[model samples]
Target chain A: MDIQYPLELIGTFMFAISGALAVQDREHDLFGAGFTGFITAIGGGSLRDIILGSYPLVWVGDVWFLYAIFLGILTAFLFHRSLGKLRRTLFLFDTFGIGFFTILGVEKALSLGVQVEIAAIMGMFSAVMGGVIRDTLTNEVPILFRREVYASACLAGAIIYLVLNHFGLDRDPNMLISIGIVIIIRLVAVKYKLSLPRLE
Target chain B: MDIQYPLELIGTFMFAISGALAVQDREHDLFGAGFTGFITAIGGGSLRDIILGSYPLVWVGDVWFLYAIFLGILTAFLFHRSLGKLRRTLFLFDTFGIGFFTILGVEKALSLGVQVEIAAIMGMFSAVMGGVIRDTLTNEVPILFRREVYASACLAGAIIYLVLNHFGLDRDPNMLISIGIVIIIRLVAVKYKLSLPRLE
Candidate 1:
């Protein structure tokens, strides 16, 4: 089994949890929260696939992903209080999720024969678009436009992966290195309170 | 040329105008407003196509659509003051646009062999999702959840179209009749201030 498959499932679960938790303080009912979680987990990847005209959207084709999302939503509901206390841990998982998603998105786009530039954009889109959509659904200005070094980290990682792959680096090592770079950039940016300059 | 082709372009242009105008009160700049207009014009149809796994997204495959959107945005920028004064006219145009979009979406989905039920939902999605995305981008709750007789009208039209087509109505008449129903429903709802009951 490709290691990426399991990792993708884990990432989906983490994203779903975060999405559900995001609406906890709002007036959303269980169904609303669950819907939000579902979109947050699958929005980015499915959007990328859709734009690329890929058929049988990932979750639609694979019932397992739905199960994972369902389990994740259940976990969020059942352990909302406990999960609230685990903010730091959830932050780490979310960071890692974006990192993995970034590289995987880049790989998928490249394999589908998109231009390198478009692939890098698609990679960043895959990592951050879910959160963007989530924030939008929750009626907040998307954190993507306001947050520190989030999508930029994914773009950086995607470009690095492409560069390494062009230099004949092995796929597995390149994936690891690229994902690590994304995580590191995110961590450092948060640790230092770094942010992009605002448009004047 | 098919009459539907020119009507589609007109609909695209009208949607873009509404989108650009939506962000005018916000802090978004010209580029931001233009981007919003572009998405508003294409978001629904493109999303329907994406979910249906149709390739070479309409805007991506056709330069004419882009030109239409550009013209729409340009019109919005050039006639901001005059357009603001023509709210009633724009509302009618917007209503007609959605009406056309709903039927086209249903027709397209049926052509792609989606289940009738899914096609109905896709038809509504194709008409309303652009406004939903536009509202979301501007950090407002999607009007779909709060507005009166918008998407529901589209869904009703879609079902009507399907029923008529199933009963052996010709394609052109079915299209016109369904679109008319949508417009009439919308007009009555707005005229009467009809709205769905709020969740308790």
Candidate 2:
């Protein structure tokens, strides 16, 4: 069994948890929260597949992903009161998920024979777009456009992965290293309250 | 050339105009407005194709669409001051654009062999999702969810198209009839201030 498969499912679950929690204090009903959770879990990956013309979107083809989303939403609803105390844990999971998603997206795009540069963008898109769409749906300016270093971390990791691959690094080690860099960047950025400079 | 070709371009142009104008009073720069306009022009169609697993998206396969979007953005920027005075005319064009887009989306989905119900939903999606995305990007609740008769008008027309085609109506006449229904529904709804009942 591929080690990435279980981790991918866990990442999806964490994303859904974050999405569900995002709307917890809002006026949304259970169905609305579920819908948001589902979209947040699948949005980035489905978009990546759609743009690359990949058929049978990942969740559509794999029922397990749906189960994972359902479980995540359920977790969010059940733990809403206590979840506030788990903010740090959730943040760590979310950051780790983005890191994993970024590398996976880069790998998938490269395998599809797209230009390396486009692959890097696709990687960033896959990690960030779900949250972007979530914020959009909830009527907030997307975090991507905010002063956060969120997407930049993914892009940096993607570029690093491309550079390493170009230098004949093996796939497994490249994936691990790139994912590590992404997680580290995110952790450091958040710890230091770092952000990109605002446009004048 | 198919008669629908020019109409499609005009519809795209109108959608872009609406999107750009939606952001006119906002703090967005020209690039932001242009990006909004482009997405509003292509969002629906590209989303339809993506969900249906169709490749080489319309704009990607045809350059004229790009020209139409660019011209639309240019028209918006050049006429930003005067465009407000033309609100009624713009409304007519926007309504007409949704009408045309609804029928075309339904036809494409039918041709792709989607279920009739799914086709109807896709038709509505094609007509309204651009505005939804645009509203979301601009940090407003989507017009679709704001008690507008917008998407329902498209759904009604799409269902009518399917029923007519199922009863042996020819494609050309069916297209015209379905589009007319959508336009009429929209006009009447707006004139009468019709809206969906709010959830309790």
Per-residue accuracy of model 2 over A1-200 as CA lDDT, tens digit each: 38889998999999998999889888999999988998899999988888888778889999999999999999999997798799998888888898889988988988887767667767987998898889888876776655347788898999999999999999899988998999898898888987653212
DockQ of each: 0.17, 0.15
| Cα-based lDDT at residue A126, candidate 1 | 91
Q: Which ranges of candidate 2 are over 4 A from the true structure?
A: A1-46, A55-131, A137-139, A144-200, B196-200
Residue lDDT tens for model 1, A78-184:
99999999999999999899999998888888878776766776798799888888888788777665556877789889999999999999988998899999999
Worst 10 residues of 1 chain B by lDDT: B26-35
Weakest lDDT window of 10 consecutive positions for candidate 2 chain B: B26-35
lDDT for each residue of candidate 2 in B117-178, tens digit (9 for 90 to 100):
99998888899898888877778878888845888988999999999999999989998899
Give the 10-residue window scoring lowest on summed lDDT in candidate 1 chain A: A191-200
lDDT of 1 by residue, B1-200 (tens): 37878988888989888888887776565655766787788889988997897877776566677778889998998898899999999999988889889988988898899899999999999999998888777777787987798999999999999999889999888888999999999999999999878779
Q: What is the TM-score of chain B in candidate 1?
A: 0.97
TM-scores for chain A over all candidates: 0.97, 0.96
